[model samples]
Target: MNLKLIKGMRIVAATHNPGKVPEIAALLGEDYEILTAGQLNLPEPDETETTFTGNAMLKARHAAEQSGEVALADDSGMSVAVLDGAPGIFSARWAGPGKDFAVAMKKVEDRLEEIGATDRAAWFTSALAVAWPGGPCVVVEGVVHGRLTFPPRGDRGFGYDPIFIPEGGALTFGEMEPAAKEAISHRTRAFAKLRAALID
Candidate 1:
């Protein structure tokens, strides 16, 4: 868990999502060299775990073992109150094999309407894990309370951003600029905790 010595070492951001790369890099700052799994051409491991922490650790360990370097990974998703967290862990699966967020958004709206539920309460949860080659792993989680919006919103973020409006925020995550969203995002919150742990 002592990551201070790794300040200048190369670390792998164990994810294939391009959108997540910059966000993670921003949080990691310039202290370390960041590389994505895709950049390293590392094969993705199956996310068969049932929880965010489990999946995040799984990915981080996989990347670390493969690259023989410290690796960081995150598992994040939207959980709808009305749906009883239906897509909590399966958020990506909800989009099917093609990863079509558009269809996934529609399904959310349809489910909401079908249930006749007015409460659109939801939250985004992110679990971040860091693993060192043949070493122990650390995991932390953060959540952003919010509500789901019908018809979706802007074209900014990937996944469910178009339909998620944060608490006390007028604009949806999709409508906000990257920096704006990053300021209060679930990932940001998780990264903050992870960063603190590392710095400590």
Candidate 2:
């Protein structure tokens, strides 16, 4: 479907994440005004969809309808090949209600150890959806193959960043600078498709 051209450059982001706002702003360019769902006090919609694309579209449509504005949504997670993608969609939930990645990271490491898994293959997937108040929407998905690192690394980025090392890269996502991470990020890749289809 075609993405409705956003007017007034105002979009309600269907997310409670403050980190995501600036990342999206950078990807979409400075001209667009990105407003977080938290800032707008919009209710965070439940992600009932089985796939990332489904969830992204659900959130985007919910936000667009609730705020009467264009809405953008991202649903992303890390999948471990050895674990059979145990945490694929439950990435955030793995962190528990406290949103503690340290605990989550430990859990991942522990799970790996429990299975005696030597394979470190993993990938991050990001699905993006943009919805207009009128009900039109555009969706895209991106993936970056990588491997998992033990004990996690660095102190930057968020979520499972510390344990993920992109292909041909030595540093984990947490260790890379924002610019470095953004350059090859799953979100950036998804936005690339969105830009080609809508913005470009």
Candidate 3:
């Protein structure tokens, strides 16, 4: 079966994270009806995979199989160059069971301090995957280079946004308006490929 998203299709978003819900819906735009695994009461699957694409594919497929519909999932994280990508796949876990990004951000900052890292070069990586029930999936990844900022700033976006300043940008993702952030977000960059392959 050809897996494609129609103009008014209903599909599971394969995520339970509140912050990710709106972001995914916004990134996918209004053409499609986006439902969440949480909304459907589908249990969030364990992300056992080590890579973004691997985890994304697992989530998407599980959601698709359970929901009996097309499913899309995103696995993303921030990696510090100096930290040797310390929090790469464990981004969410870094936030702990409470999922408090504030604590997670502090952990990152403390790690940087521990190493006396002067170069704050960092990057955000996003993996987007779409799967059809009992069918194959398509996955794509996008990355945006940037550096870390101290003390965090703003409160617009979620997760590690406040501490990350995208390359060639003055404001952190948290400081930028939703539309502004979307214009240069790792999710947007990643979804562009999915749009080309399945939507458009």
Candidate 4:
């Protein structure tokens, strides 16, 4: 996205998720000042788009327009191979209005049982977008393949972390230390792509 070309030191993180800000900041490092939509009380725009890249771009564009600065946004979710990505974009909605991830996790388990599906293959996908006020935008996507675990596990991460076991890893994301998970996270991979674009 040629972040260096952007004429500013401050950029808005176009998200309200409490868990996402710190992770994104850590990934972006200290080169730019990071501010969030919540900090500025920016109203969240409706995520009417259907794809990760579409949603991420929607949020980034909204934030940049509102804040008059560059903005970054991400849309991420878990896609089950058997479910044919049932909750791909609906991952958040699966948590229902209360946003109770516990309930959502159970729903996934129940569905698997109902279908008698034994293949637990799944993947976490993240699409990141950066946009400037009334100008250019760039989007990138990254994924981490994994399998689902029933009854969930651990208590370290938010969302579906407790149920996902990364490829070649014995521990679920919720079971890993924050730094450990960050090292191979889907978000981390996506951020690497974004960072490369900026630095290149």
Model 1: per-residue Cα lDDT over 86-126, one tens digit each: 78999988999999999899989999999899999999999
Cα misplacement distance, residue 44 of candidate 3 (Å): 1.6
**What does candidate 4 score on TM?**
0.94
Q: Which is better, 3 or 4, measured by lDDT?
A: 3
**Tens digit per residue, CA lDDT, model 2, 92-198:** 99999999988888998999999999999999999999998877889999999999997889999999999999999999999999899989999999999998877
Scanning candidate 1 in windows of ten residues, the lowest lDDT window is 1-10
Runs with alpha carbons beyond 4 Å of true place in candidate 3: 18-21
Q: What is the lDDT of residue 148 in candidate 4?
A: 97
As for candidate 4, its clashing pairs are none
For residues 1-200, write the lDDT of model 3, one tens digit per residue.
75678888898989886666666777788777888898899988899998999999999999999999899998999999998887999998999999999999999999989988899999999999999999999999989999999899999989999999999998999899988887878888999988898878
TM-score of 2: 0.94
Which lDDT values do the candidates have, in the order given? 0.90, 0.90, 0.90, 0.90
What local lDDT does model 2 show for residue 96?
97
Regions of model 2 farther than 4 Å from truth:
1-8
